[model samples]
Target: MYLDINGEQFRILKAESQGAWLVSCDAPGPPRFVDQRELDAYPRAPAPEPCTAEQGEAPQTAAEQARMALIQPLLDNGDCVSDPAIRRQLAAEAAQEHGTTSRRVLRLYYQYIATGAVMKHKPRKRRPPEYENYYKRAIQTFYYSAKRPSLRDTYDLMLHQFFTAPDGHLADKRPTWPAFRHYFYDQAYHRRSERTIARDGLTNYQRTARPLTGSAMTWKDHIGAYQMDATTADIYLVSRLDRTKVVGRPYVYLAVDTATQLIAGLYVGYEAGEEAVMACLANAAMDKVEYCRGYGIDIDAADWPSKGLPSEVITDQGRDFLGGRMKELCLRYGVTCEALPPFRPDRKGLVEKMFDLMQGRYKPILRGRGVIEADAQERWAVDYRAQASLDLTQFTQILIHCILYLNGRRVLDSLQMSPEMLEQGVAPTAAGLWQYYAAAGKSALLELNPQEVYYMSLPRKT
Candidate 1:
């Protein structure tokens, strides 16, 4: 007999004298004990034809046992019987000799030989939920259509709604507490219920739910795709023109290669508008050999060969990123500017994660008024602006140093190697990847007039 509990099917392994049936289910873990009354709800299947295997035969593999069971009777008695009573007697004797239940022995000897295949049980059709249509609608509206509410509170509210029905009648029936809990907390509405909370709802779904079934777009080469993003620096800075005058937090824009987690270009300044993005792109496109020399850092042109426009640039839906000017600039450079959906940082996670790593590295070192604590104002009780000593030039030098170290030394968890190592396959630094890609005939980098692309990327007054 099959045991059907809440649309699940289980096979009866043995019947206990205490009115309980030991059943085995397909679900993970061990067998369970089910009451006899619950077991009686399911219908019994028809018995299979009897097998002629010897009663004292040793246990064997499914195929071996099946072969023995099928031809043993012909070998012993020259014929098989069609009598059910005789089959039951044979099954009982076989069970005792094999030290197993009679039902299992009969099932294997009859079903396994007849089918000639392994059988896996299929679940039965599920019955409808206890709640009516209107109640379901109400639950959906409260739980999914709005901020997440406590399951207990939802249950209490549902009970109240039932008692205060418009027709002045209470709900006819209520489900058991276990049943209600299972439906809401352990089934379809299980862990997904937390996604309805209002705190950064779109970001929460993008970060948690979307990633489970989503994939990152792949690129054929190193410079094939570049991800750009902007974030406010946690630490405060002072003006480069005047060291005594303190500037507010600056916006840092970064462009990272998608194939390798290499930072191609970066810009740090007071404004986070389209102009900053333009500056960042220009930095990425133009040779940084001269730019680095200006800071007394001597570098050959081959040391940082990451210059040249990428085939595609992906950025989030910021005002600067979504503007038509960005697309026009990409058109001029033979590139594509793709804006990701609003509030989705995962699409541009390469750049966003870099910003987080930068913050973690820099914030602790430059502790003063620049600390990112909520009670920073109260705890320090000092003017952060006055305490800020790192001028823009000094900060820029420090940032460049950090980037160089990251490109050369930092190992990545995802790749099990540094970005530089993965990019070059042999290079010890990101510059090696740059040189190798530049040498390859299939480079996706485009030659462009920086002055022209910069002008086009700037928003025009309509």
Candidate 2:
């Protein structure tokens, strides 16, 4: 039961035939006995709803238990604990024993008595601003954009727009700059993704802020799902017919098998369009032994065994991959073509990563022999074009060597091997995994005529 005595509120702690004990509900104190006649003089208030042990309560920590134990004696003293001198002596004794201050001990005792639990003494949550929506609208209008203004500038603009009087003077009752800054950061913390996209553009957000939880292998079940993309090689090349003639950097197309992390096929050429893509597809469908032999390199079929058209090809939404020729080729070959969403290169990360590995392997040895340095674009930098020495054929041969090494010998530490493969002692190299899967009849390779695929992939004028 509760009572309203004058303006103070008290809760009934105990009721006896002679009198009743009441405690102040608003503050911590021991209960005081009041005569029945005096209690009847106060107005009764409706009882507050009962709070269960589990209601809005968290388990107490070790520190809270220790603190509560230290103050147990003071709380047991009843009304004597409210006396300043007596309470001070009790707090000092507990503080001396527990290595805490007397003030803290007294505060904790009062808190526990008022709330009935140490966990209920948490700091109160701050109230939001009354004009929260106005601040949010101002931030959205003047701050979260490609032309991002500073918070100070944003606040100034907001004041000019929303807090200006009709006479063009600033209103006296306006939010402070610190308040606006606090609210701005609070909103930004919660709307991180939305703020990044709005201020830095979607491409930048996808590249930097987006979470990388999914792997490229998630979309592939076998070796036939290939990720295809093109990148400009960092090295410059000369014309095949004349080594003295300096040609520009060539575009290199790569096809990577998602399941085995294998470089299925590659092409180095002057074009970055449908021609280069079709040529790469032709190379993938043909036997690698003959292709390496054309460059005067002899390799066993087992060394570079990846061949045949893939069941599905994943690529970015580039003009080369979205052209009519690409669609016609997929339709004729019964291949499913998947174009990734714009600015989402992580979808085809296998082929994108292959470009880096392929270029990094040869760049060190080929420096000053046509390889462009990182600062080539700076003023007074070396003329990388004049240093070009390797012709198209020589560059192609170097790339083939790198590809052979990657396919046959590179150890894949992150490869996930099945129990059967592990028991069979299958190596973790690309070729080892491919050969094992092929022998187990788990490969998705389609046996098509090499000459037919080559001729059909050739770009013809409409």
Candidate 3:
């Protein structure tokens, strides 16, 4: 019987019990199921002789006939596992691979077991061809285009071209925003350039295309190596001597142990000079019990025993570190002042990454008062220096608290353990690790004349 569907005539091969007809369209393709109600309005062709199944004239070969015989019994056994629980597990795996329900698999197994016949059916294609085509063409176009807008922008462009009429109105067939996003993002958005998507997207490309990973700097024991660098803190501060005076953002110099990620020592300074670097090194090499007491923190000497000269300190080739007096001081203490090549911060990634993490942690606490970018401060009408509440001494205490927290609690991402954990086999805090190492003679500490090391490190008149 013939009926009209979607403005085309189709032949109804059979009618299902559920009021759907197995119909074949005029297009050269497999037959499809059509609802009976849709074709009810169309006139049907005259009733013809009932269709009958035709018997095969050609006999199947022994090999071909034997194939189904083997398959039927194998499928009857349901994945060949005799145990009931194991059989179900196997059936579930097969069902997932075949994109069907486990219950459907069990039903097929039971049918084969009873009738000795295996059911073969075509699997439905869940993915739409339009989505595939649109994503492929859109990604290729955007990736090769000079003006690589963001992935979101490229999706918008895809929508505009595929779902908009020439008259600037929505077309009849259009994908929803969520569907469009899923389709586009699944097409590997990282292939685009930062010029198109910006910094966050550029990072993906860096991760994929750039060979940034290098050999890790490791040590045999604590204090075997250390990293020292200086950066201007994000928060502006009042002077230690005078609270009314607005000292610009202080340059923070930090010395950190590479093996344990412990903050050995630090110096927060207002002026840009060699004195801060010298002070930082002195702080790192000398005992910190008196230092903490000076700041009114009351830290026990055992809690922060990471003192004495390290075998080496890794730093950049800055003038403060490259001075003749600096070299003399390092040699005097039998410590190597290894200067990394220019721009190779990756050699000291531990300290660099710590700097970033530290800044992020402080951002929330110092909101509306901390070191915002100059442009952001102006745009947001934020007077960071004027709003600053922490004096140099108070800021130092806060920094100490931050360092202690990191050593004690912050899990190191690469190691999947805290610095304190590696420092002491089971130390719960960085200080605990330090104390354990100090008592066990595992700390690579070299006793030095602090007074001599300090004076030698002092910048001499050029």
Tell me, by lDDT, which candidate is best: 2
TM-score of every model versus the real structure: 0.58, 0.63, 0.56
Runs with alpha carbons beyond 4 Å of true place in candidate 3: 1-222, 240-242, 361-363, 368-380, 416-425, 435-442, 457-459
lDDT of 3 by residue, 215-249 (tens): 34344355557788889888877766787788778
Clashes by residue pair, model 3: 148-196, 234-371
Global lDDT scores for all candidate models? 0.62, 0.80, 0.64
Error of 3 at 125 (Å): 10
lDDT of 2: 0.80
Q: What TM-score does structure 1 among the candidates reach?
A: 0.58
Worst 10 residues of 1 by lDDT: 74-83
The residue pairs that clash in candidate 1, if any, are none
**Candidate 1 residue runs with Cα over 4 Å from true position:** 1-142, 161-188, 193-204, 213-222, 298-303, 322-328, 374-383, 416-442, 448-462
Give the runs in model 2 whose Cα sits over 4 Å from its true position: 1-137, 161-191, 201-208, 271-273, 296-302, 317-319, 322-328, 341-343, 408-421, 457-462
- From the highest lDDT down, the ranking of the candidates is 2, 3, 1
